[model samples]
Target chain A: MMNKKTAPVGVFDSGVGGLTVAREISRQLPDENIVYFGDTARVPYGSKSQNTIIRFSEQIIRFLKTKEVKAIVIACNTASALALDAVKDEFDIPILGVVIPGARAAVEATKNRKVGVVGTEATVQSGMYTKVIQGMNPEITVIEKACPLFVPLVEEGFKEHQVTEEVIEYYLESMRSTDIDAMILGCTHYPLLRSKIRAYMGDKIQIVNPAYETAMDLKCLLEENDMANDGTEGQHSNYSFYVSDAAEKFRKFANTVMPFDVPITNVVNIEGY
Target chain B: MMNKKTAPVGVFDSGVGGLTVAREISRQLPDENIVYFGDTARVPYGSKSQNTIIRFSEQIIRFLKTKEVKAIVIACNTASALALDAVKDEFDIPILGVVIPGARAAVEATKNRKVGVVGTEATVQSGMYTKVIQGMNPEITVIEKACPLFVPLVEEGFKEHQVTEEVIEYYLESMRSTDIDAMILGCTHYPLLRSKIRAYMGDKIQIVNPAYETAMDLKCLLEENDMANDGTEGQHSNYSFYVSDAAEKFRKFANTVMPFDVPITNVVNIEGY
Candidate 1:
């Protein structure tokens, strides 16, 4: 069973935004190999419906399964919000999504009853945050905003721009009007636009990022499953990134976002998947 | 061959941004039925590489060809820049990309012999504008900048925000330093942010939109080939939209941008193509 510990973790996202989650997972697990698939060809799954996102998630999981992953991480919030259960049902291996872990982290971090969620349109539409937060603490009030541009802006490398700041302000105006004490960066891409979002929300609003929590959860899962990699100090761990289209761009994005460089390859044409 | 004019003119893009192009095509050719495919599933193709964009363009063309389109319009700037030749070569039918039409228009519009091109990274990096312009008039100076964030900001509906404007200002600052008499909004998504771009460049700079030029080109091509739609006067032209994923979002975008409402279907998986 322990041999499975080193079997490698399979993580997939619509595009490079999942690198945030991958970075966290790498930080927490350190020793295990990670096989990351960014469906660059068919990215931005956030605006897609539950049915389409679910179908895409199934195909991605199936593709990842071929890589012999012991567990699957649905690093996309939109996918997790709409398709986690569908994926979990379809796959025998343990699966984790950014939503539940993020929701749980938000619940733990929020001192006031009021909490806000900002993500892509699909995430906001699903009311996943309200459902998950209400399930955890029935009396807590949840406010959600669909900042549809955040993902695209981040992917386009608009990390800190005046226009990005203004867009964030416009999108967050409703959330700011509320008495929310904490906000969840519901989408992975949202974190890349952190300075703008935080500036808009101000210091009082505790921002919850699921990437960190998901990483922690992944560590727990590996330990529980006896899938922890062999302990050796300063051992090199391998990471391979696969994007459905635009491997060159994904490689450039990897250099821009992550601290350590990981090689990116284009193998899948996810249009059919 | 006149019977060929009865067939629909097919247009495809990464997302709803293509609606700008489609709307123009519709306005110019009221008699023509338009079949549009928005690859909303994997959008923002601006930052990808030449090879991936080429592959995507070919796949989209293959799908459109199945509908028996008389002509195909690549409404996307990145795809046009990177894959126009490949697409034209792959299909036996007449194919038109926005670049040549836009380039021709920019050449005509420019009086100072200095032209600027603003688009996605992929479009800019391909240096398509330089090549196309040089091919026409070697004396025409070309300046290009990759306004990567523009597409996301527009899709997010922050076209007129202070922050978005500021980001535009930052991206266009270098262009402003040059003596560009005319600027080509190379990416379809850029037109959505045209007002802001115009504001930054001031009134002196003429903006050449390829979509508009493409519409004119399509009209001319139909007239030349005698394949123009000959539907009865006052008949409503219909458009059918298909996407690899996110039919609903495509519908939302179409409703927002197109002159007429579009019914969307997610019919083909691109991987198989």
Candidate 2:
């Protein structure tokens, strides 16, 4: 039998983008430990094929398995959208994906039932959000746009930069006329540039962050499954972070995006798995 | 003895950026056959480690060797900068890199002996251009800047877009003070943004494209080694193209970057090599 009370929850993204997810999880469940893996070497999973994405996801999962995680969260939207269903049954532990939580959030937040989704090409093309949202509310309309350059813009540390604003406008210009009440930041990287996205979309539209909802969903799952860590509320725990390549750069980027400093980040060879 | 007169020449890049190189080679050596490989799966080699770049370059070379190429041209600036010297002696056939030709062109074009170089992080960090140029002219001043976002901008087809101009200005701002008489477009993808780059740098500072010089060097090397494809000038040769992932997308991007259509691009498992 596996010990669930103290085992860390595993969270992974293609790269630093997923730090937003890990940060949310840390804020929502302070006592619980988190093991975050960023595949920086073969990043931008948005452009890779489903098979390749699944293979890369499986390798990351296999590596996470070594950490004895109580649950695994697919923080990267492209991986969750294209790969989760294929590997969900293979693992004995709980497997959570961001798309369902994100979709649910959008469905709940959108009063007009008109929603826009912006993500990587792979995520939008997967039709996962549309399928999930439509399944929940039969009449809700979904407009999905693949903003490929957004990831690069965010990765290049251009959150509030004018160039990033220009790119956001370029990708989202048509969506302004669509009159969507709510928009989903479907890609993990998109949350980092939320201010610019919101500025471009106007104040009337609501922005949904999958990371926050995913963390909440994980917390609910932990309680329902009786797998919640039983430690005191203020229990101190060390969060372990790992990346496929360039730990130093990942750390610096994490510190820039998050409120706290990333003290120790390790580099691991993900291909071996 | 190798039958060089009828064999194809090999060219490899990290992704579609190298198509610019292949196109240049076609313009310079129309009768010669070409074999191009784009490692789209592991692209943006600008940030990868030297060891990984060399490993990837060697695998690509091995795959290209299977095509029976008489010579190999590393069209990618990062690969040519970090991996060439390590693999130059491993192969018996003629091996050439873009860095040398680009450096030579910069040295020849700069009247004030002051030159500026712009490329990917890995290529610029490698100091290959600075070393080669300084070796040629010890008194020449070389300033190198790594414009990391340039590739993604070009890949997104933002040649004349406002964002592209902002990013170009953002990257080249500091170099305005260097008073360099000439600037080298060290990365293959850069030539696509020549108009924007030239406009920003002003007409006085000459822009040097390594692709032209690299193609010319390849031509010279072929004739010097008696390996020139000496069949009739109108001899036909199929230009084969391969990528590690997304053949269809690569073909589309090729058409956007190059003047002609890429009829059929094949996908290969570069890791297996």
Residue range A22-92, candidate 1, lDDT tens digits: 98988888898899999876677887778778888888888888778989999999998999988898779
Question: What is candidate 1's CAPRI-style docking category based on DockQ?
Answer: medium
TM-score for candidate 2: 0.93
What are the per-model numbers of colliding residue pairs? Answer: 13, 0
**Per-residue lDDT tens digits of candidate 2, residues A147-246?**
9998887767687788787788888999998989999999988877888888889999999999989999999999998878867655676688899887
By summed lDDT, the worst window of 10 consecutive residues in model 2 chain A runs over A229-238
- For candidate 1, the per-residue lDDT at A5 reads 62
lDDT tens string, model 2, B1-273?
556788999999999888888888898888788998999888878987787788888889999999999999999999999999999988877899999999999999999999999999988888999999999999999999999899888876687788888888899999977799899998888998999999899999999999999999999999998888866656676688899888998888888766666779998988678
Model 1 residue B59 distance off true place after TM-score fit, in angstroms: 2.2
Which 10-residue span in candidate 1 chain B carries the lowest summed lDDT? B259-268
TM-score (all chains, Cα) for each model: 0.91, 0.93
Compared with the true structure, the alpha-carbon lDDT of candidate 1 equals: 0.83
lDDT of 1 at A84: 93
Residues B178-225 of candidate 1 have per-residue lDDT tens digits of: 889999999887877888889889999999989888999999999999
- Cα error, residue B193 of model 2, in Å, equals 0.9
Stretches of candidate 1 exceeding 4 Å from the true structure: A193-202, A230-236, A255-266, A271-273, B231-238, B256-271
